[model samples]
Target chain A: MLEVKDLRAGFEGSEIIKGISLSIKAGEVHAIMGPNGSGKSTLAKVLAGHPSYEVTGGEVIYNGENLLEIEPEQRALKGIFMGFQYPVEIPGVNNAEFLRMAYNARQINEGKEELDPLDFDDILTEKMKMLSMEKKYRERNLNDGFSGGEKKKNEILQMAILQPKLAVLDETDSGLDIDALRVVSDGVNKIKSADNALILITHYQRLLEYIQPDYVHVLSQGIIVKSGEKDLALELEAQGYDWLTPTN
Target chain B: MTTTLVDASDQAESALLNLHKKFMSGNRPPEALVPLNEAAIQRFELLKFPHRKHEMYTFVNTKELVSTVFNLPGETVVSKDFIKSHVYPECESSYLVVVDGILNEDLSDNSAIQSSINLVPLKDAVDQPEIKEYLADTIEKENDVFSAINTAFISQGTLIDVAAKKQVEAPLQILHVSTGSASGNVTSHPRILVRLGELAEFKMIVKYVGVQGNYFVNSVMDILVGEQAGVTFSQVQEDATDAWHYSKTRVQQGRNSRVKAVNAFFGNKITRHHFEAHLKDVGAELLLNSVSILNDAEQVHHFVRIHHEAPHTNSTQNFKNIVNDKSRSSVDGTVIVNQGAQQIFSDQLINNLMLSDNAHADNKPNLMIFADDVKCTHGATVGQLDENQLFYLKTRGLSEKVAKELLTKSFAESIVQTIDFPGVVDYLENTLLKKLEA
Candidate 1:
């Protein structure tokens, strides 16, 4: 469903994701783990069509289309979703209303009837119930004053509502407590389907224990150095990325 | 060439003075307001029209307003349908309609709230003691030429008085509509005085609307809150595109009294609003919020001053401006804590969102604290929408235009949500959305 060929992207004049290539098929889950400043988030942002990053050299094809040519909003409408590591806090936009807008946008894109507030409320309520999110999240401003764990849960809630085909979860497990982590993982697992794919970007293997990935790729210095099964995560957890570092 | 310009400016200045003289010549004020009118005219003469060199009018350019020749407004008869369409649905039977600065008793119906509150035209209430004591007394007339001019022609206005220990559930609506004369441009001076007794609670929504043609509406409103009284005042200024609006609102709070004033400006070619809230007694609280959405060549200026005169007083001022195209908006807000007013808390914030490169916003949030152990903070921000915020909304599948409009509406919602009245919020939201779309 997704293919990245020699993705070379960065901000300004500095290169971050240099000469990285990866591919994922339908229903496949991939884990991209790297050390700090290893361009893990940069790759996610590049795929999400972030405006700040310049793709100097790369080709990303999603669903037989050049995904890089699509606008950020068009990407989302075309079933591309990026779970931001730090979701922006919009102080006055109600969370429920924002979710409804996103849902309706996707509905319109797919030639479906738009849902009004009352109709959308039922869908939103069911999604929140499935995720075990508090009702207060519906009325509060979008991510304003939300705790770190709550923000991550909200992201997962968005993923559940939109039901995106390709979701890049960037640092989704970084700020969650044990209970919240379990709840978020359960939400992702419930939303997972045979036709959808997930890319979990993380620095630790704790989240892997809940939703195991089909493939694990180790990224260092803007390049993937190793690719293996789920056990590679355990080996990396035990020995750390130091052993993977090349001695020029 | 310079002499010709000076002559034109002098002719414009004298036009207003001549209009005042002609108005007083035909209609003599009541005996109780004779000296007040005389003193106001004298003050107007001494102060004259504001120039660019004036400190208070530095950011506000009055060249166009002062150069225009304006005649005293003639009688204006508006249809009942127009009044009904302009007023909020909740205030159907509890409204006062003022046309061309004169209260239209035939069109106004306060029967729903007349039992709980006293609603009288200023012309008929001049003999009352409260009217004599508080009328035109709250505003500072030393430097405000508009206030002085409004006082000079304050015979026709509205006076509202709430008794002690009364909780008026119905919101009082004052609709000021300006209809220029058929002959030429006209000017109207509308005045309002509201007094709440001890422990009284009241809510008011003042709305301004105008018909086509160029006209000026100079309005003055004074509100006095008694001990433990609470008041919520919402002012919506939606004048015509060619109209000029100038208003001065002064509020005085008694011991333990609370007042919340929300001002929303959406129309008018040029608007100047002067607001002052005095915490005269201890424990008095004041909340002042203003939102101005302007586009094209529209200009709006706000001068706000909050005085913490007594100990333990608190106040918050939030002013937001959404300027688009070539429009310009300025806010000069100052909070002063007296020397002995300790334990006072105050904060002033000014947020301006410039939607276009040609748009401009000038904000000055000032703090003058003389008392120790007081908490006061003031900050101003002038910028376009946050790029990160915009990108976030766009990534949610919202189109770029929809995303920008939503973000703009959210910026003003922070202030709009603070308004507690029903129907007013919906009206403001619709107006804001229309402006954003435009």
Candidate 2:
């Protein structure tokens, strides 16, 4: 579903992701674990086509097409979804209206029928029940006064509504409590399908316990140093990331 | 540096002299308003047009009125087609049409609301006792030059009197349409007087519509809310591109009365609005909410003041301004708590969104708390749209233009949603969207 070849990117002139290559097939879940500032989140943002990150030297192929030239909105239309570490607070836009518009955008891209307000309400209410979100959240502004847990749940709610092909979760468990973390992980586990892929980027190995990953890659200073199975996560959790860091 | 108001331009001085001559020669109604008109003329003579050097007129170019030749109120040739096209199509209301400062009997639709209350032309209400008492009670004609001008040269207006305990469901629509003069620029002064008795309820919608010409529409409204009464007044100003508009609304609330005033300004070359609310008795309440959108070289100004004269009174002022291009807008809000008006709660907020680098927004939020127990808060914020918000919306598959329109519409939605009338909210939303894109 996704392929990256020597993906080197950065913010101004300094490179963050230095010559990292990774590829994943459909129905597979990949976990990229790294320390702070190890380019885990930068890879997610670059793949999502953030304007501030310049692609120094790299190529990204998604769904058998070159993805570097696509705009952020077009990338979204092509089923590229990024769950931001901190969702932007839009104070005046209604959450329900925003979700409906996003859902309709994808349906329109694929030439599917768009749902009206009444029909969308039924679908949205069903999804809210799945995520255990209160109906009142639909009436409030999108992430305006929501707590940390509510923001993460809102992102998951959008992910469930959009049903994108490749979903990248960047630090979705950082600010959540134990209950919220379980609920979020449960939501992602429920939405997984054989035709879609998931990329879990995190600083800790705890989230891997909720949703098993097919492959676990340890990222250090922008490059993947070790590739192993779920047991590698336990190995790293027992010993710190220092034992695995490669010497120059 | 020192400044003097006596050194104003000679052209404006001559303009004032010509208006005085027209006022003297105009026919009188032989009513109690004659002396009030004379007193207003005397006051206008004492304080000519406000100059740019004045503290209140510093940000505004007061000379815009003096540079052009504006004719006095004359014949109105407004047709039925113009009136039908100008009013809101979907909103249902009882209409009162004032064309070129003259009340048109044939164009108004008072029959729809005939059973609610008393609505009559001001000139015909000379014999009514309530109209005589509330006509010039709340407005300050002696200090405000425009108010003085409106009083002296008032051509035609309305008088709305609600009987005790009467509640009117239909909103009274006052449409001030300026069909520019055929000879030269025209100036029309349309006045309004509203009086609600004890426990009475009323709703009014004032709309200003004009043709494309060099014209000036100076409007004034006086409202008196009796004890336990509730009133809501909404004014929507969408004048012509070449028009200069000035409006002043003064309100007074008795004990336990409530008043809510909403204003939206969209189109004008230069527009200035003054709003004042006086809590005359204990437990009086006031809410002043305004929204303005200006682009290009258009200019809009708002001067708002709320006075807590009695104990246990509450007042709130919220204004949102959206400016783009090279346009400029200013808002000055002041909340005054009297010496004995303890337990008073007043707040003022001004939010400005500047879309372009050259657009200017001058905001001043002031509070005068004489009583130590009063609680008053005021703040003003000016900023561009959030880039992170834009990016978030774009990632949801919305194009840049649609994202911006959504955000801008959301900025004005909080106020627009408060309006419960059908189609009014949609009309305002569409109009604001068009203005933002323009």
Candidate 3:
């Protein structure tokens, strides 16, 4: 469902991720474990086509479509979702309004009938139920005064409502509490199907307990150095990333 | 100096001398600070109108009317039914009215007005020697010629005294309407004096509308909030297309008091002016907001002065302007904190949405603080609507006009978000629709 070949990205002129590649199949959860500044977030942002991160090299193929040249918003329309590590706080924009806009942006690209307010409300209530979230989350300002946990939960709620073919969760667990993490993971799990995929990026083994990835990859410096089954997460959790780096 | 705007004939000399004589005597309205006013007028007469070298009045060129004697029309608006139909009542509180720059019995509702709210016309207040003494000692001003000119004209204005520990039921509305021009230029000074007592709560809306054409309106409103008095003051101006409105407001807030003012200018040829909250005692707060949609050759200039005088003073200043056509706008925000006033928190934000390449907006929001413990922030930005956001909205099914309306609402949400009164919000939205025709 998702493919990346020799992906390289950075901020401005300084390249960070030298060259890296990874792939994930449908219904499979892939965890990218790396230390801070190890390009774990960069991979997600670059795949999502963040304008600040220039794709210095490589192509990202999502469902047989090359997404390197598409706009970040267009990539979202093409069923590519990147849960930002730090979502920008856009004040004065309503949460429901933003979600409706994102949903309609994709619908426009797909040539589908955009839902009206009543229709969108009906859809939203069902998604909120599936995601095990409250209905009031849609009325507040867009992450303006939201707590870290609430912001993360709202991101998952977006993922559930958007229902992208391939969803990437980047550092969604850093700030969430245990209950919020469980709810968010449940939301991610509910959206997964035979034709959908999710990429979980985390430094700890806690989120792995909820999502249970089929494949675990140990990313170091700018590249993924190890690829294995779910057991690699437990080993890495016990030892940590300091032991994975090659000694000079 | 732009004194050269005066004619060279004998008429000019006598006019200048007539101007000096008319401005120098009895210059302070309500007879407030008579000596200071007289001395200030002397200094003001010595200097001519500011020239292009002065950056403060750079975009405001008043060379057209500096030489004209705009007579105050004698046909006073004295119909009681007309006043009752037009002006909102303050019978449960206090209110006053100035008809053709003179306090009229038919215009003001004073007697039977709530005892908690003391409503007195400035002319009648002047007749009371003790009240005149109190005003003459307390009110102060620098040598601003126009303000002093307002004093010399000394027509009439309402004196509203809201008693301490009283909350007025309805908003106190002061309606100032213009009519009947007698010459090339006709002017009227509708003065307003409001003194909200301690711990009292009130909302005052000053509405300015013109019924006739080619008139000049010089209006000033003075508000003094006593300790712990909470007040919300707003001004709505939708003057006639052929009129010019010059309005200035000066307010003083006392200890633990809250004073907020929003000025919405939807008029022709207006120069909106202000000085606010010069003395903020402990825990006193002030909020100033202005919104304008400029069109054609109309020019709107907003001058704001926020001074924090005591510790723990809080203030906010925001003005959103949308300028189209060849219109020009200027916002001059000056915030100052005294040397002894500590822990002052102040913010000034000005945003202009320019709809035409030739339209212009000059925004200067500044702060001067002598205190050490303070939080101050000021910013100004002029930009067209974001193309990405606009395109995104259009693609989402909102038409271009609806999208523009939403964008404008978003731009103004911060100010309206703080407004709690439904009538104010509804009236403002209706006036906005009628003003913009969108």
Q: Which has the greatest TM-score?
A: 1
Give a tens-digit lDDT track for model 1, residues A1-248: 99899999999889998888889997989999989888999999999888999999989999999999999999999998899999999987999999999999999999999999999999899989987899999999999999999999999999999999999999999999999999999999999889999999999999999989999999898889888999999999999998786334
What DockQ would you assign to candidate 1?
Answer: 0.73
Q: Sorted by lDDT, highest first, which candidate order results?
A: 1, 2, 3
After superposing candidate 2 on the true structure, give the runs of residues whose Cα lies further than 4 Å from its correct spot.
A1-25, A30-46, A52-70, A91-97, A107-129, A132-151, A171-186, A201-248, B1-11, B89-93, B120-142, B281-284, B310-313, B340-347, B371-377
TM-score of chain B of 1: 0.95
Give the per-residue lDDT of model 2 (tens digit) for B1-438: 123334445657677667666665664533655755666666777777776676666667887686677767566577887777656643344788888677787988767677887866677775676665555543233466887788777655667788889998778778888886556788888888788999999988888988656789988888889999999878888898788998889888999999988888885788989887889999999988888888888889987778899999999888888899988899977788989999999889899998999999999889988899988888999998777788888888887888888888777776666555545667788786578876
Clashing residue pairs, backbone N/CA/C < 3 A, model 3: B27-B151, B33-B136
Instruction: Arrange candidates, best TM-score first.
Output: 1, 2, 3
Better model by TM-score, 1 or 2?
A: 1
Candidate 1 versus the native: TM-score?
0.93
Model 1: which docking level applies?
medium
lDDT of 3 by residue, A1-248 (tens): 77889988898898878778888888888999989888898887787765567888988787787878766666666677777676655444677876786677667777998888788988788877765666777887666678888778777778877888888889999899898888888878778888888899999999999999999988888888888999999999889888887333
Candidate lDDT scores, in order, read 0.88, 0.83, 0.72
Between prediction 1 and prediction 3, the one with superior lDDT is: 1
> What's the i-RMS for candidate 2 in angstroms?
1.3
For DockQ, candidate 1 versus 2, the one ahead is 1
- Show model 1 residue runs off by greater than 4 Å: A225-227, A234-246, B1-13, B120-141
* Model 3 TM-score relative to the real fold: 0.81
| CA deviation > 4 Å runs, candidate 3 | A101-119, A122-139, A245-248, B1-48, B54-59, B64-116, B127-140, B179-184, B211-213, B240-243, B266-270, B293-298, B322-327, B351-359, B379-408, B427-438
Reference-based lDDT, residue B260, model 2: 88
